[model samples]
Target: MSENIGDLFQEVMAIKQAGEFELISALIPYAGLVGLELIKENAGLITILRNKPSNIGNTTIPAVHGGVVGALLEHAGIMHIICECDTTRFPKIINISIDYLRPCLGTMDTYARGYVIKQGKRVTNVRIEAWQSDPSRPVAAAHAHFLMG
Candidate 1:
């Protein structure tokens, strides 16, 4: 699996350099498993998406699973680090703290963006927000630490 991830990273970097845009999401296995898509916007911002039905955690309120949300946020942070740094090896997640602000309605797609708060030689801190429909109203947010070294 680790080898596969490395191979995926190589493919991702290749497409990224080619500016293919849409295919970058295939680099992360978890993203593909959960239907996460990568959207490249202007001003160097990256948005991650999780499409509907497959991500529902609760059918009653139709909320996305907390684990899925966390994974999505973590993936964003990982990507942010990858883009900001020079390494192809996957960053190791040191810790992540998530805040669930509202129910992630399973009917709509979920989106997230990660911000690198502090970056060091061996570690980095990132903040992430997940939303549906409106960026101002995030369904969940997270603070994460990663060991890039």
Candidate 2:
């Protein structure tokens, strides 16, 4: 039998404390979501922020959409909080909050890193930053609270 994709992905996850955003991106449905490199540090942290070609019909001024950025943060947060707890299962997200700091410019993709500030029996708190072209300048930031199921 062929090796399982989940098994392969899990193997990939085991190797890199920092996940492969490109591979992860492939699994994500959003095609516009380009996987940028990690900009910050802290274990179990994951961030996906990036710019894609202006489809023109999507948004104003050809910038990344807020919804995509929000979804990225949510995904990053889930990846992060779960890393903090090596349980027999993946943590579920009750909800997430993302605040846009600025409009992401340039043709480059932005990346965010989410670190767990708190992980308890019921919930987890994550903080993430989204930046592009330069990590020093972040286009958006988010603090997410995830309810562990």
Candidate 3:
């Protein structure tokens, strides 16, 4: 099953189209569970996490779970690598550090985008930011390192 996942990832990476990119979240069960969607804009690709009742962590404030936000940051970084980098295999995460700046409202969708800081032979560094209502005010930001073997 893992081998099949690897093959699917490689195939998707080879195509690298907007529609084909959407298959990535579907390929990973956890991503599907979290309702992650990929969108391609004039600037670049962006990720959206559709809010659902299951994702709500704070009932009083109705905020999104911290873990879900972290997952979005990590996934955004990986998606950026897959779309921008020349690689045959899926990148393995080395370490990820995230900062939650504001509460992500659970009533609306969350958007995230990643930028590649540096791409080395075996490691890639990416920065991701997630926002709910406005792009200027980010709800969370993250830095991640992936081992692209």
Model 2 residue 18 distance off true place after TM-score fit, in angstroms: 11
- Tell me, by lDDT, which candidate is best: 3
Candidate 1 is scored at a TM of: 0.85
Which 10 successive residues of model 1 have the least lDDT summed?
1-10
lDDT digits (tens) for residues 79-125 of candidate 1? 77766667656779999999999998878788888888998888889
TM-score of each: 0.85, 0.67, 0.92
For candidate 3, write residues 1-149 as lDDT tens digits. 63644567656865585446776676678888988989877798899999988998999899999999999999899998988888868899999999999999999999999999999999999999999888999999999999998
Candidate 1 segments exceeding 4 Å error: 1-8
Give all candidate RMSDs, comma-separated: 2.5, 4.3, 2.0
Q: What is model 2's C-alpha RMSD?
A: 4.3
lDDT of all predictions, in order shown?
0.79, 0.61, 0.89
> Model 1 clash tally?
0
Error of 3 at 87 (Å): 0.9
Better of 1 and 2 by lDDT: 1
**lDDT-superior candidate, 2 or 3:** 3
